[model samples]
Target: MNIDLEDELAAGMREHTADLKPSADLLDRAARRNRRRTAAMASGTGVFALAAVVAVAMTALGGTPAAPPVEPGAPPAPELLTVAMVQERAVAALAADDVQHIVSTVDYRGKTEHGEWWFDQVTGDSRITRLQAPGGAVTMDLWQLVRDDKLTMTQVFHDDRSYLVLERPLDGQRPPGPAGSTPDELRAALQRGEGYTLVGPEDLAGRAVLHLRFDFADGSDELWVDAETYRAVRRETVKHTPDGDARNRLEFEWQPRDDGSLKPLAVKVPDGYTQRQVPPVDGPM
Candidate 1:
């Protein structure tokens, strides 16, 4: 009996459980648990994949990226304005203000002379009142009026008793150049100029302005235009001379009437003055 005890126990245990089988409910529960674990693992993997895709999409769409930190104390650069843009703005501003009053002063050969100009853009009429030196010796006050394509000049002599008046057609009486206080003339001069440079912003007569320099064949021009209105405020012309340079300056101040009409400019002939009429010529008079 001692010798067969281990073999007998093994045989009895096998025979007792020979008909055993798992219940259907238990099998179903095990399958459901397996499916749930599989579904949860798939969901977690999908979430990770979706997160990666979203990050890639944001980068592709140029989403806001981190900016490099800027230095603590740096000044920004000033904006640059072009010459053509300034000229265009100036021309537009001048055209909007159709009337202009200009005071020009010329200093040459130790002589200083003052001139006044009135220009009407709508009527194309102008008046110049100045002192002229005909032969470089005597200075006489002269008034020049341009109306209806005609020029009339009245000169008051030194004695104040004798005066001279001359009238001529203006078709070819003057050379082809900037002939008025209009900004169109300045724009044209800038277009035909050889060298153009922006001298930077400056203060002229207590007003901010842009300083522009242009060179021509015989002379050069320095123009100061208002920063806000883009209108010409002052201009200086330097003419090359054998002895020295002759500087001519023009200062413009616009006076727009409250009625939106041009101011009247009167030029009258002196009493008992000699009148002379010049015959119309083809070239400059």
Candidate 2:
């Protein structure tokens, strides 16, 4: 939007303002919403470098004389969004009003796994599925459902054609993952984006998003968040595990819960699959 706006603005403007930059008000508007660190953006690295952009845009557009230069080492004004604020918004994505859907990809040790998870934050009900190496093969499946105030978990291993069902009390058990997905667990993976820097605003799937990058002790990651909703949209990370460097990509969407949406989330057992008394050595998710 800024780029297109700048182009259109430059076309109709006079030559004196040809060097005009983005509006300071626009940057401030974004900052108010994003809550980025004021100190960091002062370096004029990203779009928040409003000291130069605003001065140039305002002076040229207003036809005013340029201001005198500072003596030296003047502090730069700050504005723009940051990772912490976005994560805060995304962490609240588990609003009881609707269901949260997450699509995740994990690439590790020469194999790739794709997963989809759906969970009711308020009700603590969820359905999680995984496909290993594609080709329509489901490696793992799990579902937690609440019926008549009783909660139950069913775990399935398609390769072994076996499943385990256990009745669980709905007290304080948190959602488990790589099979289970929750907003808090998902946010924890990003470590609250401790030192992320802005890569600028970008468009993903026709939706406006903010891109941020960070490096941790063992790896680095890129996170994308919805500009309007402030929910997590996508993530890409490369981490050095004991085995090797693992790469993963996660995508998210918020869906309105309805009967139609429940069809796919329902637990289904194949006609010939056997029910097991115990889970695999890896344990139940």
Candidate 3:
């Protein structure tokens, strides 16, 4: 029985075993499944690589970067010279101009005066005419002339025939120190910025101008300088006095002749007018 047991088991296993083969359709289905799995893995890898590249690009380009923080009560950055350095340039330009023609209007104490002035830088010659309205009516007309450093004043009455002319000496007398009258003086005053400040930019006579202010011991002056030419276009002065507040305004119009020279001005006494010669004053005219 022991000897027959091994052979009987072998024969029994052999009898139960049967030969089987895979079909063409089953093999085709298995190949298709393997290809789909490979394709899916490749697509996932490509998406990961694309995401990494996008992240790098954003970092290099500084996308959505944060701004620097500012400290409390910190002073602002310095402005460019175009805005702050204009005053100095204006002063220099005005000082360099040799000849000037000015038309001005003055309003003081409820009275208005219109004036015309011509100045010669080389010969120190000037002519000035003023038309004044005392009380809303044209009441007075004054003319002043300067030639070869000599000054004369003429006053005309209601009747043009009655006019008084007074001749005065022009020696050692300082010229009027209005904002635009003396370029050298104004330049010096502005250089000392202790009391000078730039108000801002404004429109004057249809042109861009810089508004500057100067505070002095006696009064304060407001000047409007052309932005492009650096010329003083307008000026206003307010003086403090015991009597009251004295205010003055000066407007300048620079007229250069076609020859690029100063226009000539002539001042001659009217016909049949009596001329009076008076002693010269010791002061400046």
TM-score of each: 0.55, 0.60, 0.55
By descending lDDT, how would the candidates be arranged?
2, 1, 3
- Model 1: lDDT to the true structure: 0.56
Better candidate by TM-score, 1 or 3: 1
Tens-digit lDDT track of model 3 for 133-183: 322333334555565566666665534545667766778553342235556
lDDT of 2 by residue, 192-234 (tens): 5355665556768766677778877998888787766767788
Q: Output the lDDT of residue 18, model 3.
A: 40
List where candidate 3 sits over 4 angstroms from the true fold: 1-79, 82-84, 133-159, 162-180, 193-195, 216-219, 257-264, 276-285
**TM-score: which candidate is best?**
2
lDDT of 1 by residue, 90-155 (tens): 767766645677777787887877776666655455555664532243334455567678877666
Q: Count the backbone clashes (under 3 Å) in each candidate.
A: 0, 0, 1
Candidate 2 lDDT at 165 equals 94
> Compared to the true structure, candidate 3 yields what TM-score?
0.55
Residue 144 of model 1 has an lDDT of 58
Give the C-alpha miss distance for residue 101 in model 1, angstroms: 1.5
